[model samples]
Target: MTNTMWMRGVEWLAASAADPRACKWEWDHGEGIALLEAGRFWDVLSVPERLGLLTLDLLWRPALPVPGPTLVDLAAGRVGFFLPPDPDGGWVGAGLRYATRGSWVAVPPPYRPARSLEWLVPPDGTGTLHSPGTLEDALRQANGTLAVLAAPPRGPRES
Candidate 1:
Protein backbone atom coordinates (compact mmCIF):
# COMPACT_ATOMS: atom_id res chain seq x y z
CA MET A 1 0.00 0.00 0.00
CA THR A 2 1.09 3.58 -0.67
CA ASN A 3 2.13 5.91 2.13
CA THR A 4 -1.10 7.81 1.84
CA MET A 5 -3.05 4.59 1.97
CA TRP A 6 -1.13 3.52 5.06
CA MET A 7 -1.70 6.86 6.73
CA ARG A 8 -5.37 6.53 6.03
CA GLY A 9 -5.36 3.07 7.54
CA VAL A 10 -3.62 4.39 10.62
CA GLU A 11 -6.19 7.10 10.95
CA TRP A 12 -8.99 4.59 10.63
CA LEU A 13 -7.52 2.41 13.34
CA ALA A 14 -6.82 5.31 15.63
CA ALA A 15 -10.42 6.36 15.35
CA SER A 16 -11.34 3.20 17.22
CA ALA A 17 -9.94 4.71 20.37
CA ALA A 18 -11.95 6.89 22.71
CA ASP A 19 -9.42 9.62 22.05
CA PRO A 20 -8.07 9.36 18.56
CA ARG A 21 -5.65 12.20 19.19
CA ALA A 22 -4.16 10.45 22.17
CA CYS A 23 -3.82 7.24 20.23
CA LYS A 24 -2.09 9.06 17.43
CA TRP A 25 0.21 10.76 19.88
CA GLU A 26 1.17 7.41 21.35
CA TRP A 27 2.01 6.08 17.92
CA ASP A 28 3.87 9.22 17.00
CA HIS A 29 5.91 9.11 20.19
CA GLY A 30 7.13 5.56 19.53
CA GLU A 31 4.71 3.78 21.84
CA GLY A 32 4.28 1.26 19.01
CA ILE A 33 0.84 0.02 20.10
CA ALA A 34 -2.29 1.26 21.80
CA LEU A 35 -5.26 -0.40 23.42
CA LEU A 36 -8.42 0.34 21.48
CA GLU A 37 -11.98 -0.35 22.44
CA ALA A 38 -14.03 -2.90 20.57
CA GLY A 39 -17.73 -3.21 19.62
CA ARG A 40 -18.08 0.35 18.53
CA PHE A 41 -17.29 0.32 14.85
CA TRP A 42 -16.02 -3.26 14.90
CA ASP A 43 -15.49 -6.39 16.97
CA VAL A 44 -12.59 -8.77 17.09
CA LEU A 45 -12.62 -12.54 16.80
CA SER A 46 -9.42 -14.03 18.05
CA VAL A 47 -8.29 -17.63 17.62
CA PRO A 48 -5.15 -19.64 18.10
CA GLU A 49 -2.46 -18.87 15.60
CA ARG A 50 -2.49 -22.35 14.10
CA LEU A 51 -6.18 -22.30 13.37
CA GLY A 52 -6.04 -18.67 12.37
CA LEU A 53 -3.33 -19.37 9.82
CA LEU A 54 -5.31 -22.27 8.35
CA THR A 55 -8.46 -20.21 8.26
CA LEU A 56 -6.66 -17.36 6.55
CA ASP A 57 -5.32 -19.76 3.94
CA LEU A 58 -8.79 -21.08 3.25
CA LEU A 59 -10.16 -17.55 3.13
CA TRP A 60 -7.68 -16.67 0.39
CA ARG A 61 -7.83 -19.89 -1.61
CA PRO A 62 -10.81 -19.07 -3.76
CA ALA A 63 -11.65 -16.05 -5.91
CA LEU A 64 -13.46 -14.49 -2.99
CA PRO A 65 -12.81 -10.91 -2.01
CA VAL A 66 -9.99 -10.03 0.32
CA PRO A 67 -10.58 -10.23 4.05
CA GLY A 68 -10.29 -7.33 6.46
CA PRO A 69 -7.59 -6.45 8.94
CA THR A 70 -5.99 -9.33 10.85
CA LEU A 71 -3.55 -9.06 13.73
CA VAL A 72 -1.19 -11.80 14.77
CA ASP A 73 0.25 -11.87 18.28
CA LEU A 74 3.29 -14.06 18.02
CA ALA A 75 4.02 -14.07 21.73
CA ALA A 76 0.46 -15.01 22.55
CA GLY A 77 0.02 -17.38 19.62
CA ARG A 78 -3.21 -15.67 18.73
CA VAL A 79 -4.69 -13.98 15.69
CA GLY A 80 -7.40 -11.34 15.82
CA PHE A 81 -9.68 -10.67 12.83
CA PHE A 82 -11.67 -7.47 12.61
CA LEU A 83 -15.40 -7.73 11.93
CA PRO A 84 -18.34 -5.42 12.05
CA PRO A 85 -19.90 -5.21 15.49
CA ASP A 86 -22.50 -7.83 16.28
CA PRO A 87 -24.82 -6.48 18.91
CA ASP A 88 -26.54 -9.84 19.30
CA GLY A 89 -23.30 -11.64 20.21
CA GLY A 90 -24.04 -14.52 17.84
CA TRP A 91 -20.57 -15.86 17.20
CA VAL A 92 -19.55 -19.12 18.87
CA GLY A 93 -16.77 -21.62 18.17
CA ALA A 94 -14.43 -23.86 20.11
CA GLY A 95 -11.33 -22.02 21.25
CA LEU A 96 -12.66 -18.79 19.79
CA ARG A 97 -12.49 -15.55 21.76
CA TYR A 98 -14.59 -12.59 20.82
CA ALA A 99 -13.78 -9.04 21.84
CA THR A 100 -17.08 -7.29 21.80
CA ARG A 101 -18.43 -4.22 23.57
CA GLY A 102 -16.31 -2.96 26.42
CA SER A 103 -13.33 -5.06 25.48
CA TRP A 104 -9.90 -3.68 24.71
CA VAL A 105 -7.41 -4.84 22.08
CA ALA A 106 -3.79 -3.84 21.66
CA VAL A 107 -3.52 -2.51 18.17
CA PRO A 108 -0.35 -1.63 16.36
CA PRO A 109 0.16 1.29 14.05
CA PRO A 110 -1.11 0.28 10.63
CA TYR A 111 1.76 2.14 8.99
CA ARG A 112 4.45 -0.05 10.56
CA PRO A 113 5.02 -3.37 12.28
CA ALA A 114 5.22 -3.83 16.05
CA ARG A 115 7.25 -6.30 18.07
CA SER A 116 5.27 -9.46 18.80
CA LEU A 117 1.89 -8.14 17.81
CA GLU A 118 1.69 -7.15 14.17
CA TRP A 119 -0.83 -7.15 11.41
CA LEU A 120 -1.11 -10.22 9.27
CA VAL A 121 -3.51 -8.30 7.06
CA PRO A 122 -3.52 -4.57 7.66
CA PRO A 123 -6.51 -2.35 7.20
CA ASP A 124 -7.05 -0.83 3.71
CA GLY A 125 -8.50 2.46 5.09
CA THR A 126 -12.00 1.84 3.76
CA GLY A 127 -13.54 0.70 7.06
CA THR A 128 -13.79 -2.73 5.48
CA LEU A 129 -14.12 -5.70 7.80
CA HIS A 130 -14.59 -9.44 7.52
CA SER A 131 -18.09 -10.77 7.05
CA PRO A 132 -19.09 -12.60 10.21
CA GLY A 133 -20.81 -15.39 8.35
CA THR A 134 -17.92 -15.90 5.99
CA LEU A 135 -15.41 -15.84 8.82
CA GLU A 136 -17.43 -18.30 10.86
CA ASP A 137 -17.55 -20.70 7.91
CA ALA A 138 -13.81 -20.50 7.42
CA LEU A 139 -13.19 -21.03 11.14
CA ARG A 140 -15.36 -24.12 11.18
CA GLN A 141 -13.57 -25.54 8.17
CA ALA A 142 -10.19 -24.83 9.66
CA ASN A 143 -11.17 -26.40 12.95
CA GLY A 144 -12.29 -29.56 11.17
CA THR A 145 -9.05 -29.68 9.22
CA LEU A 146 -7.05 -29.37 12.41
CA ALA A 147 -9.06 -32.11 14.08
CA VAL A 148 -8.47 -34.45 11.16
CA LEU A 149 -4.77 -33.72 11.14
CA ALA A 150 -4.55 -34.37 14.86
CA ALA A 151 -6.41 -37.67 14.79
CA PRO A 152 -4.31 -40.80 15.10
CA PRO A 153 -3.73 -42.89 11.99
CA ARG A 154 -5.98 -45.91 11.77
CA GLY A 155 -4.15 -49.22 11.92
CA PRO A 156 -4.86 -52.23 9.69
CA ARG A 157 -8.35 -53.63 10.14
CA GLU A 158 -8.59 -56.60 12.49
CA SER A 159 -8.62 -59.90 10.61
Candidate 2:
Protein backbone atom coordinates (compact mmCIF):
# COMPACT_ATOMS: atom_id res chain seq x y z
CA MET A 1 0.00 0.00 0.00
CA THR A 2 1.09 3.54 -0.68
CA ASN A 3 1.92 5.91 2.17
CA THR A 4 -1.34 7.82 1.61
CA MET A 5 -3.41 4.65 1.65
CA TRP A 6 -1.58 3.43 4.73
CA MET A 7 -2.24 6.73 6.49
CA ARG A 8 -5.91 6.46 5.57
CA GLY A 9 -6.12 2.98 7.00
CA VAL A 10 -4.52 4.15 10.21
CA GLU A 11 -6.97 7.00 10.42
CA TRP A 12 -9.88 4.63 9.94
CA LEU A 13 -8.64 2.39 12.72
CA ALA A 14 -7.90 5.23 15.09
CA ALA A 15 -11.43 6.53 14.57
CA SER A 16 -12.51 3.78 16.96
CA ALA A 17 -10.75 5.52 19.79
CA ALA A 18 -12.12 8.38 21.85
CA ASP A 19 -9.27 10.53 20.54
CA PRO A 20 -8.23 9.69 17.05
CA ARG A 21 -5.56 12.35 17.12
CA ALA A 22 -3.88 10.70 20.07
CA CYS A 23 -3.80 7.39 18.30
CA LYS A 24 -2.26 9.01 15.28
CA TRP A 25 0.33 10.70 17.44
CA GLU A 26 1.32 7.42 19.04
CA TRP A 27 1.88 5.82 15.65
CA ASP A 28 3.72 8.84 14.36
CA HIS A 29 6.04 8.71 17.37
CA GLY A 30 6.81 4.98 16.79
CA GLU A 31 4.73 3.56 19.60
CA GLY A 32 3.94 0.83 17.05
CA ILE A 33 0.39 0.28 18.31
CA ALA A 34 -2.57 2.09 19.79
CA LEU A 35 -5.32 0.72 21.96
CA LEU A 36 -8.72 1.18 20.34
CA GLU A 37 -12.00 0.63 22.12
CA ALA A 38 -14.35 -1.96 20.76
CA GLY A 39 -18.17 -1.83 20.18
CA ARG A 40 -18.73 1.62 18.84
CA PHE A 41 -17.86 0.84 15.23
CA TRP A 42 -17.05 -2.85 15.58
CA ASP A 43 -16.27 -5.76 17.90
CA VAL A 44 -13.60 -8.44 18.02
CA LEU A 45 -13.69 -12.20 18.08
CA SER A 46 -10.42 -13.79 19.16
CA VAL A 47 -9.43 -17.42 18.77
CA PRO A 48 -6.37 -19.60 19.15
CA GLU A 49 -3.76 -18.96 16.50
CA ARG A 50 -3.88 -22.46 15.02
CA LEU A 51 -7.63 -22.42 14.56
CA GLY A 52 -7.57 -18.82 13.44
CA LEU A 53 -5.09 -19.58 10.69
CA LEU A 54 -7.24 -22.40 9.41
CA THR A 55 -10.37 -20.29 9.52
CA LEU A 56 -8.56 -17.54 7.65
CA ASP A 57 -7.54 -19.98 4.94
CA LEU A 58 -11.11 -21.17 4.62
CA LEU A 59 -12.36 -17.61 4.41
CA TRP A 60 -9.88 -16.91 1.63
CA ARG A 61 -11.11 -19.56 -0.77
CA PRO A 62 -10.95 -18.51 -4.40
CA ALA A 63 -14.64 -17.68 -4.63
CA LEU A 64 -14.96 -15.89 -1.32
CA PRO A 65 -14.50 -12.19 -0.71
CA VAL A 66 -11.54 -11.17 1.37
CA PRO A 67 -12.19 -11.08 5.07
CA GLY A 68 -11.90 -7.93 7.21
CA PRO A 69 -8.91 -6.84 9.24
CA THR A 70 -7.37 -9.46 11.53
CA LEU A 71 -4.70 -9.26 14.22
CA VAL A 72 -2.27 -12.02 15.09
CA ASP A 73 -0.21 -12.04 18.25
CA LEU A 74 2.39 -14.73 17.80
CA ALA A 75 3.69 -14.57 21.35
CA ALA A 76 0.17 -14.73 22.71
CA GLY A 77 -0.85 -17.45 20.28
CA ARG A 78 -4.08 -15.62 19.55
CA VAL A 79 -5.73 -14.13 16.48
CA GLY A 80 -8.42 -11.49 16.54
CA PHE A 81 -10.97 -10.90 13.81
CA PHE A 82 -12.79 -7.59 13.55
CA LEU A 83 -16.57 -7.82 13.24
CA PRO A 84 -19.58 -5.58 13.33
CA PRO A 85 -20.84 -4.97 16.84
CA ASP A 86 -23.68 -7.26 17.92
CA PRO A 87 -25.74 -5.47 20.51
CA ASP A 88 -27.52 -8.73 21.30
CA GLY A 89 -24.11 -10.37 21.99
CA GLY A 90 -25.41 -13.70 20.62
CA TRP A 91 -22.09 -15.12 19.51
CA VAL A 92 -20.92 -18.35 21.14
CA GLY A 93 -18.25 -20.95 20.39
CA ALA A 94 -15.72 -23.12 22.19
CA GLY A 95 -12.48 -21.25 22.89
CA LEU A 96 -13.77 -18.08 21.32
CA ARG A 97 -13.51 -14.67 22.99
CA TYR A 98 -15.77 -11.74 22.18
CA ALA A 99 -14.54 -8.24 22.93
CA THR A 100 -17.18 -5.56 22.89
CA ARG A 101 -18.72 -2.67 24.74
CA GLY A 102 -15.95 -1.62 27.12
CA SER A 103 -13.22 -3.84 25.72
CA TRP A 104 -9.99 -2.43 24.32
CA VAL A 105 -7.85 -3.94 21.57
CA ALA A 106 -4.26 -3.12 20.70
CA VAL A 107 -4.16 -2.28 17.03
CA PRO A 108 -1.03 -1.67 14.93
CA PRO A 109 -0.87 0.83 12.15
CA PRO A 110 -1.74 -0.52 8.71
CA TYR A 111 1.18 -2.06 6.79
CA ARG A 112 3.57 -1.35 9.63
CA PRO A 113 5.65 -4.09 11.23
CA ALA A 114 5.22 -4.68 14.91
CA ARG A 115 6.87 -7.12 17.27
CA SER A 116 4.70 -10.13 18.16
CA LEU A 117 1.41 -8.37 17.34
CA GLU A 118 0.54 -7.34 13.80
CA TRP A 119 -2.29 -7.25 11.34
CA LEU A 120 -2.72 -10.35 9.26
CA VAL A 121 -5.20 -8.52 7.07
CA PRO A 122 -5.09 -4.76 7.35
CA PRO A 123 -8.21 -2.65 6.94
CA ASP A 124 -8.65 -0.91 3.58
CA GLY A 125 -9.95 2.30 5.17
CA THR A 126 -13.54 1.44 4.24
CA GLY A 127 -15.00 0.56 7.66
CA THR A 128 -15.71 -2.96 6.46
CA LEU A 129 -15.86 -5.78 8.95
CA HIS A 130 -16.53 -9.50 8.94
CA SER A 131 -20.13 -10.68 9.17
CA PRO A 132 -20.56 -12.51 12.47
CA GLY A 133 -22.66 -15.28 10.95
CA THR A 134 -20.16 -15.94 8.21
CA LEU A 135 -17.25 -15.88 10.65
CA GLU A 136 -19.08 -18.28 12.96
CA ASP A 137 -19.62 -20.70 10.12
CA ALA A 138 -15.97 -20.54 9.10
CA LEU A 139 -14.80 -21.03 12.65
CA ARG A 140 -17.04 -24.06 13.11
CA GLN A 141 -15.79 -25.60 9.91
CA ALA A 142 -12.18 -24.94 10.82
CA ASN A 143 -12.64 -26.36 14.30
CA GLY A 144 -14.15 -29.54 12.87
CA THR A 145 -11.27 -29.86 10.46
CA LEU A 146 -8.75 -29.52 13.27
CA ALA A 147 -10.52 -32.09 15.38
CA VAL A 148 -10.45 -34.63 12.56
CA LEU A 149 -6.78 -33.99 11.96
CA ALA A 150 -6.00 -34.49 15.62
CA ALA A 151 -8.04 -37.66 16.03
CA PRO A 152 -6.21 -40.98 16.47
CA PRO A 153 -6.01 -43.26 13.47
CA ARG A 154 -8.42 -46.20 13.56
CA GLY A 155 -6.75 -49.63 13.43
CA PRO A 156 -8.26 -52.69 11.79
CA ARG A 157 -10.90 -54.35 13.99
CA GLU A 158 -10.19 -57.82 15.35
CA SER A 159 -12.27 -60.73 14.00
- Put down candidate 1 lDDT per residue, 61-92, tens digits, no spaces: 55778988999999999999999998877777
Evaluate residue 103 in candidate 1 and report its C-alpha lDDT on the 0 to 100 scale: 92
What's the TM for model 1?
Answer: 0.95
**Mind sharing the TM-score for model 2?**
0.94
lDDT of 1 at 31: 71
Q: Write the per-residue lDDT of candidate 2 for residues 75-158, one digit (tens) a residue.
A: 889999999998877777777888999999888888775778888888888888887778888999999999999999999999
Model 1 C-alpha lDDT versus the unseen true structure: 0.89
Lowest summed lDDT across 10 adjacent residues in model 1 is found at 87-96
List TM-score per model, in order.
Answer: 0.95, 0.94
Which residue ranges in model 2 land beyond 4 Å of their true spot? none
Give, for candidate 2, the lowest lDDT window spanning 10 residues: 1-10
